[model samples]
Target: MTGEPFKLGDRERDEIKWSCGAGLGLLTRYAPGDFTVTLRLQPENEKRDRLDLGLLRKPQEDSDIGEGHETWVPLIKNVTSFEISYFDPNANTWLPRWPGAQLPRLVKVKVGRSDTAVPWEAIIPLRRTPY
Candidate 1:
């Protein structure tokens, strides 16, 4: 399922919670200007499978508003052992937020699958250190 504008409001959160069955839960929250997403998967036994979480962005050049050329900005991959996976735009070592570019506008979750790695484009600008 694909959703546009990528903002998870209260109603969307409620729907996600209701749609989740006995062994699943979806948690979302906003921190300042950024958002956080967490997926909880519970199984009866020890058996589990790997899951990949990706953040995609639409290119500015695309004509379609929400259905533009989507690119995978790899968040986490080959996550086999962890039962809980989360993505927080504010706190991540892999991709630091830049000054002008916008945050990811889309999220993609894949189970037992892998995609080609895409390197983050922007470089974190250096700030002056206070003495």
Candidate 2:
């Protein structure tokens, strides 16, 4: 709510509240140590884009995701559009900006690829919440 604005890569929004914390993955129960995964969209060309995943070993206390030794891995390529939405349980609605300390109940990712005519979408539910 404060600062310049919330920016996801080049796009910016002033309504979303950004927080700093660590989150567990699907292998958190089987594995150990803090695991954080950050997804970002990088432009491949003027009309296309690519999705990149950043892996962090330690927890970050600040808003910046570049605190520890992170690895950038390409997850998908030839992405024409990438959109993320957070489901707010209290509001019973999906929002573009996930604003709060607690994690969203469901995270939705929609991707449009150049190779395919139909867009791909996925709705992932988070098992853990800060509350």
Candidate 3:
């Protein structure tokens, strides 16, 4: 992948604390607009990995519960499913996700890794609202 400059915020950077969470160790801050947030994922074993995303209109009350002025847009399965169903991480589990939809208001990405798991870095591009 292309090695572009990446930045992390205090909240985003704090995800490293959990061994089950993303371990890229790079935190970043992205505003609402056209953006591409990328993450690095190295799977440790063989399992189903799905990603989730949310874009908050405002800061979240609690980051763990996945709250905020958050607008949710799930990820696609294997880039091919992006035009189909969508992604969801309601229980923080890695399975039974990806309900792909055509043209979503994509804001963030949540990765659900199965098997041995890996360090998954999420990259999300902000979608322009076609009014």
TM-scores for every candidate against the unseen true structure: 0.23, 0.55, 0.18
Off by over 4 Å in 3: 1-51, 59-70, 76-112, 122-131
Which structure is stronger by lDDT: 1 or 2? 2
Worst 10 residues of 3 by lDDT: 11-20
Predicted structure 2: clash tally: 0
Ranking by TM-score: 2, 1, 3
lDDT of each: 0.29, 0.51, 0.28
Clashes of each: 0, 0, 27
Which of the two candidates, 1 or 2, achieves a greater TM-score against the reference?
2
lDDT of model 3 at position 87: 25
Candidate 1 residue-wise lDDT at 120? 23
Writing each residue's lDDT as its tens digit, candidate 3 over 27-82 gives: 22343332222333222225843323321132323354544343333332332111
Clashes of 1: 0
Q: Please tell me which model should have the higher lDDT, number 1 or number 3.
A: 1
Local error of candidate 2 at residue 110 (angstroms): 0.4
